[model samples]
Target: YGAAEAGRDYNTTDMSRQRMYNEYLPPYKAAVEAGVGSVMSSFNDINGIPATANKWLMTDLLRKQWNFLGFVATDYTAINELSAHGLGDDKKVSELALNAGIDMDMVGEIFLRNLAQNIKEGTVKQADVDQACRRVLEAKYRLGLFQDPYHGVSEARAKQVLMQPAFVQAARDVARRSLVLLKNDNQTLPLKNTANIAVIGPLADRPLDMLGNWSGAGDAKQAVSILQGIKNVGGATIRVTYAHGANVTEDAQLIARLNEHGGQLDIDPRPADAQIAEAVAAAQKAEVVVAVVGESQGMTGEAASRADIGLPGRQLDLLKALKATGKPLVVVLC
Candidate 1:
């Protein structure tokens, strides 16, 4: 729920606000109403306010107005976010979180460690502590965890529910509904069957990164790559040539981290000159150069905020080289 970047893909403030109200809020409200026990808020500061301790999201949205009786948990160590989130120091953050009605402090023992001192110092009201603890106890009572703590999950069930086909199909349905066709220019309609088609780009050939960021439920193995899609669109006679024009990122830190995680995008962190030369050569020979350009999977997701989101490294240089080749350039902006 961070603010949309200025002048980028989803940069408008009004668009961002609309997403919060129309997209993210309703499901949460529904979950609370379905007799759900509790909700754990986020670690990242949303709209410059930590969701864990935001008065608007926690007090106004969940408690006072929604009348949610369920307990609220903080995302791991999010209670001590005062120091990291620029709220204040650890002590102030603890007080803020407790007062904000967070019941459980995950990972960070801020409340257990400092609630007493905060009460003595008049930074936190004792009534706030009682209310939070009461909510937690109420949740435990509702779950019957006190009488039967380990009743729901079992090893047999865990193995059997590796992946329920019904669940997978439901997810696919949601994805299909959310799908937006970016371009469908006149009678480019269903692209007539052609024997010669160029499947050229960094992503066109790489299936792994096609799933994009935070693909937790997405089956990477099952998801078809662009190359697979093109092949599926035609028969054996259709010819396809793939060229890895440029890497996903040129940042040294990002490349090192990606390499550490066994990522394919950071294949070779050599100078941009070598990759550009190779792409230029391939583009020069082909009838069309479908150049792929953009950040890596983790580049724009969590902790991936950027002061400048301009094309990474010498990709522009590579594109310029490819353009000089005079082939029909069909850039795939990822």
Candidate 2:
């Protein structure tokens, strides 16, 4: 149930929304072709209502039109999410969910809370309910859940799968390619061998923020942090220093949330003055100041953006201060 807006923000213009919709349809159609069994949409409300209750998305686009042979599940309580999106009251939201062909509602209390009234009001037709239930049953049948739900479990298979060389290689390739090179001025593409160098930044020494949203399957212990990567590339001797410098934001509430959810990238968002002082101190002492700054993981990704693009809090002040140190500043904006 992902929103149609592209480029990490939900305030997509009408023209941009149409373009994103066009881009989104083809991949979904391909997934159907690959014989997918079920589709669970996302948490963000798409357009007006959450994608879970959006009939236009599940029914019109995926089921009736694309002929997807899979049951559709909402991101989470899409019915309740409708209320949050300000689409309608609870009863109306439940009616919308069934009509939209959501086979199973997750966390949406409407199915349990107000279904009877929805059915009585002519707001939802019985046929729509039946269709959704039928789709769920079909999915269960295809999965052999009714026949033998536990058919595919085996210790031997699990061991063999883990040992598969191809899977290992694929994982390695994914890890390597996922790294985005932020700067390579004058073909400094591959880092040169230098005996003494400083890896300075709040984020440079940390690994947790590398994976953003929906990073459901990664092991923090298994991931290589930026600092770790540098150490592994032993061609050059490296000197590394980490400064938590400033928190990602100055807002106390925002910092508290980031502390819970953000990896290394998230920190105790501090006052602008604090951040600027730390950054300026570091810059004054360094030959090159690699100033990594931006919104924290919670600040600007999926459904996050600002009318003002300038750095939040006193971070911009920190940057200005760093520039005053006269060290070359190379910033990495996420």
Query: Of the candidates shown, which would achieve the greatest lDDT relative to the real structure?
Result: 1
In candidate 1, list every pair of residues with a backbone clash. Answer: none
The alpha-carbon deviation from the true structure for residue 174 of candidate 1, after best TM-score superposition, in angstroms, is 4.5
Error of 2 at 315 (Å): 4.7
Summing lDDT over every window of 10 consecutive residues in candidate 1, give the lowest-scoring window: 7-16
Model 2 weakest 10-residue run by lDDT: 6-15
lDDT of 2: 0.65
Q: What's the TM-score of each model vs. the native?
A: 0.69, 0.71
Model 2: per-residue lDDT, tens digit, 1-334? Answer: 2444554443322335566558756787888889898888665665555676677778888877778877888765656766777768888778777777777887766777777687789888877777777988997787798998877778978878863789868977896797687666655345455443344455565555555455676556655656566668754456544455555566677666666664444454455566567656655665555656666555665455555678776666666776677755666554
Listed per candidate, the RMSD to the true structure in angstroms reads 5.3, 4.8
Q: Model 2 compared with the native: what TM-score?
A: 0.71
The sequence of per-residue lDDT tens digits that candidate 1 reaches over residues 100-167 is: 77888998998889999999999899888998889888877888888988867788986677557786
lDDT of each: 0.71, 0.65
lDDT of 1 at 295: 65
Model 2: which residue pairs collide? 1-41, 1-42, 45-50, 77-106, 77-108
